[model samples]
Target: MRFLRQSMIGVFLAAVSLGLLVYAAYVVQSAVQARLSDDAPAPPPRERVFAVHLERAEARTITPVMETFGEISSRRTLELRAAVAGRVTALHENFEDAGRVTQGEVLVRIDPSEMQAAVDRLSADLADAEAEIRDARRARDLAGAEQTAAEHQVSLREKAYNRQLDLAGRGVGSTAAVETAELQAAAARATVLARRQDVARAEARVDQAATRLLRQRIALTEARRTLADTAIEAPFSGTLSDTSVVEGRLVSANERLADLIDPNDLEVSFQVSTAQYARLLNPEGGLIDTRVLARLDVAGVDAQATGSLSRVSAGAGDGQTGRRVFARLTHASGFRPGDFVTLEIEEQPLPDVISLPASALGSDSTVLVNGEDNRLEVLAVTLLRRQGDQVLVRGEGLEGRDVVTTRTPLLGPGVSIRVLRQEAVVSAGVPDMLELSEERRARLVAFVKGTEHMPAETKERVLAQLAEREVPAQMVARIESRMGG
Candidate 1:
């Protein structure tokens, strides 16, 4: 009976402990549920105080271009060399380093004494030659008179010989007398023949004298030309470069004195990778004439020059990865040869694509589509080209779609991004200062607001960019002024 009572007490105690444990578990469950209900995300704090930077879509023509590098060079590069050996007597006042000059301007004058002396000697010889010509004419006239007299004498002797022969044959006179008459006629004929020979000799002498005079005249003319070369004249209007010649400097014939360059005909030379060159080649396999731009880093002097592709080297250079190209600059002010510069040449424009900031495109081709949580969306885009500070993307929905103008490099696919100052970013992002359109404006605004969470300040900047984006006809006119039909 005592053992049964102890067992009952132990069983009662265990049942009470189990009931206490169940009650404690129910209380902890109630506390956890209340805590979860209290923490339910706080209702996504709405930052309507600061306006998000937004912009509308725009309808404007955008030129798709390719960019390349190049160097400045002058088209007219002349090596001023001495045409004749002489001491440089004078250099023009404009013959200084980088000095401008005019065509036909005498840049240098050699000591013309020797050339002048040669001219004088030639002139004297030419005069002597002329006098000899006159003498030759006089001699020719005398020979003509002698020749006429010899002809008449020969005629008379022939008649006399005929008479003597007849008399001897008829026996009308003594044989000795006829023989003597014949001998007399023969002697007369001999005399005429000797006189004719003298006349022929005189004619030949006249011709010799005339030929000598002609040769002398030619020598004189050559001397005169040499004398003129003593003074060096500028071939064209240009600037003088590498001018190391000084007055009184001895310059030998064919010696390099200096160089002349025409800045008006300036060119930009550059090298392009083989792939780039191939892209620029036309269908005929020749280099295409592409538009080019040059940027100079002069303080307050961001001047730009226009150019066209001239040619590319036929063969690749040794160990060079790209082909060499030359472009002719239309307006080349403040440009000089050997000036280290970077050129952004406009290559062929790609079609069926739109341009946007790299930041806007998310990783794996994802992009922010709509409403605040940065609705991550994917775009079926064909990446065409990448220019400095710009990218050309093409796709079915890309043309009319508003893309993020600028973004941080860290932006990736599915990553959240708050669009700030969309319109302002686009205008400020490129070399050109232009505004956005209504369509692009709305697109930009929607893109910015769609961010899951955006800072108030960022939203305001984005909105301000949208406001700046104006599809003003005035701005269009300004852009048109730079282009032509």
Candidate 2:
């Protein structure tokens, strides 16, 4: 009975311990659930916005420039030709290609032996003709004297015949004597007529001799002219090109010998679309004298010259579109024919136009301007002109507004934007001169000098710049790039 009572006491103790453990577990679970039910710390406040570059739109008059490329050519070019066929015997000291020649300078001489011989022969013929003329005059004078003597004899015979007739009538002379006298008179008359015929023949010979002398003189003149043509003279001062003649070479008449080009009188010939061509004309349908800047980039050196629009081609070339125009360069010292150059032509000034970066414009002629609350607003703009990286636009109510200078896919109308920095808008003007170091200047000068094809004036200009303490940095960079340095 005592053991049974002890076992019940142990069971009661175990049950109490188990019940306490269950109550403690429930209390811990309630605390854990309450901790999780509390609201978590809110995320940091975030706003979405696009960062972009911004520029202001200002109303101003802008002169738009149309850029094109063309080849330089001389305003006057002559193809030197051989006027007479002969073997080349002589050439001037400066008669080679690229040789400079002055007007009236003799450049070549053909073999004059043949021409000289012909002239000499003609001269001899002329002298012979003159001698014949003199001889014919003498003959004519002798004929006149003979005719006079024959007429005197005829008169004497006539008087004798008359005497014989009178004697016959008076019965003192015989009829045979009278008849003889009459026949003698008739014979004398015939002799006078023959003398007259001889005089006429002599006069005809004189005339023939005179005509022959004239013909000989004309032939001699022509021969002398041919002789002079053997020497080819420069018609004007210019540089020689495309020379094919050499000493001992036989050339035919009218064959091209060389080309002479007046490099000073250079004009740039370029073609432009019909629309651009129309803009270049005036109200009277004539091309306006628009200012043009021609630039030739050679080995990173810029040979620039100013010019004016001169004229346009009367008709379009075969298989060619657009009108061909020419610009007469002024002070084109370093320019040459066949030089491909860049031409910048100034157009009429556009008034009250806004200039913006080209990237700011959308393909549909719309731009994103920051409107109220710094939000982007799509604005339609008229693209007046595009100059390099910038565009001239005409938009209503666009002045004094900040326009986004760069476009991105993320940017659109009504999208909030944060301008990183406000850019100062300036006009696109001439490129600034660069400053270079002495070493760079020397290098550029050497390179310019080493270029054999560069014109003298261009070399001089480059050298002058190199002589300065500072050279254009852009020019140096260009030269270095080409030098592969």
Candidate 3:
């Protein structure tokens, strides 16, 4: 009975296993049959079309602009220095930092008391020298008269000696008388010689006096110059900066007192890469006088000035790369020295070139142009110049073709694209207008009207635009972006 029961259980287990195998087979067969019976081929893979902004390439001559940062400075800046050391006794009312001064304006006065006293003393000494000179002349004249009298006496004595000798020879005069007359003549001649020596000494004295007078006059002139130097005067009309002197302050000779800057003689110094610098050069290898515009932002307002390229730095400055350039501004009304400014310099114009967004250029110096059937084709281009965010390129068959402004890695040659924005709609110079839905118009108008930071004139203009049948799409977009919608 136990064997029979075991056999029955085994048979039952086998039967259940067989039934499970059959049900699995049936499920697999039904699935296979269903898939095979559908007989529908898989649809061909569709190409993905990327939406991109496109700009039409139009060949024309365009002057590329190179933008750089620069510093504004004065071409004519003078350091105000004290020419003589003294204590500041007087100060001009406007002799301070940022003071406006005109030509020949006295800015400071060092204590002139000492200089004046020196000058007075020198003048007195000069006067004494002149008086001495006059006295020497009178003495010289008296010595000459004395010499003449002595000479006349000598002549009379000689004549008397000759007469006495003649008398002695003729036996009318004694030998003693002749000898005495001869001795008297000799004594008179000696007196004449002494007078001549006195005359020479007087002439020498006169020369000495003249020399002393000249030296004293020079000293007096120098003292007067020193006195003049005590008063500091402006050499030109300009503005003063960095003033350091004050009333009653002691200053040394050649001490820097302030800086005088000619606001009219303004210049901007900027640096550019070697490649860009080459573009600014003419065929003669000298820097061309390219037109430039300098802009300074002051309190949210732009101060613009026009200028021309002046010269290139003789050497690249220490710890810097590229070429340093200078530009002379024509009219710098609201600019000052050492102000940081923006410079836009016009480069040589490139003919038969198209200015495209920088992103349109590929890493391989190739650009993707729109081909037939909305496909993109890679074309080799020559890069002429780079103007800020744009690049100037020239290539064959690149004109009149739409270029993708913004490129992505997913986009490549032979890929399909959907032009999200056309050249006319996205152009910078033209105004893009479109009819807006009433709801959108109302929302934008409400957002613009509610903006407190917006100026009234701008707000009014925006409202007026919205009221028209067609409104500018850029303005609407800007308004919506501000609305956080």
Per-structure clash totals for the candidates: 35, 1, 0
**Candidate 3: tens digits of C-alpha lDDT, residues 1-485:** 99999999999999999999999999999999999999798999987889888888999999888889999888889998999999999988888887889999899999989999999999999999999999999999999999999999999999999999999989999999999999999999999999999999999999999999999999999999999999899999998999998898999999999999898899999989888888899999998868899987542234689999988999888998989999999967767788889889988877788998899998899988888999989989998877778889998889988898888999998999988765544546756889999998888777767776543445666678789998777666666666677
Cα lDDT of model 2 by residue, 437-472, tens digit: 667677777888898887777778778877876666
lDDT of 1 by residue, 26-107 (tens): 8999999888879556676753222223333233445556565667888889999998998988989999987999999999
Ranking by TM-score: 2, 3, 1
Global lDDT scores for all candidate models: 0.70, 0.90, 0.88
Return the top candidate by TM-score. 2
Reference-based TM-score, model 1 = 0.64
Model 1, residue 294: distance off in Å is 2.1
Model 1 misplacement above 4 A:
1-63, 184-196, 284-290, 356-382, 393-485
Two-way lDDT contest, 1 vs 3, winner: 3
Sliding window of 10 residues with minimal summed lDDT for model 1: 48-57
The TM-scores of all predictions, comma-separated, are: 0.64, 0.74, 0.71
Candidate 3, residue 115: how far the Cα is off, in Å: 2.1
On lDDT, the candidate that comes out on top is 2
Q: How far does residue 61 in candidate 2 sit from its true spot (Å)?
A: 2.3
